[model samples]
Target: MCKRVTCPNDGKPTWWGCGAHIETALAGVATADRCDCPHVPVEGNPRMFEVKKTEDQATA
Candidate 1:
């Protein structure tokens, strides 16, 4: 399995790849081993999230 990591700059999830690939994908920016970094803040309440349907999905 590939290692799952979050991007340091955008806080987006990234899958495992070679060091060079990871670095290139991240644009040479360093990343943390885990999520919940300062760039991305987790909500204390789960209710804050809403499941929004896309236009196509909504129409379907």
Candidate 2:
């Protein structure tokens, strides 16, 4: 599971990329790799949850 994407269509967050919305978001991000969606912050859930960095951000 890709813990860096969500249902962009509904704005609902997910630990794994939502198969339905991922493709949608992926099309929008020019730099997205494979199923990676650039719009998807490396941080997972954040509804009332706040984290300074996501997995990708940490790597960077």
**By lDDT, who's the top model here?**
1
The TM-scores, one per candidate, come to: 0.24, 0.20
Candidate 1 lDDT, tens digit per residue, 1-60?
A: 234555444445554433335345445344553333232112564322212333554486
In model 1, the Cα lDDT at residue 33 comes to 38
Candidate 2 shows a clash count of 0
Candidate 1 TM-score versus the reference: 0.24
lDDT of 2 by residue, 19-60 (tens): 344345445444433322234333554322222344655476
Q: How accurate is candidate 1 locally (lDDT)?
A: 0.39
Runs in model 2 lying further than 4 Å from the true structure? 1-19, 28-32, 35-60
Candidate number achieving the greatest TM-score relative to the actual structure: 1
| Residue 56 accuracy (lDDT) in model 1 | 57
lDDT of each: 0.39, 0.39
Q: For model 1, which pairs clash?
A: none
In candidate 2, position 47 carries an lDDT of 29
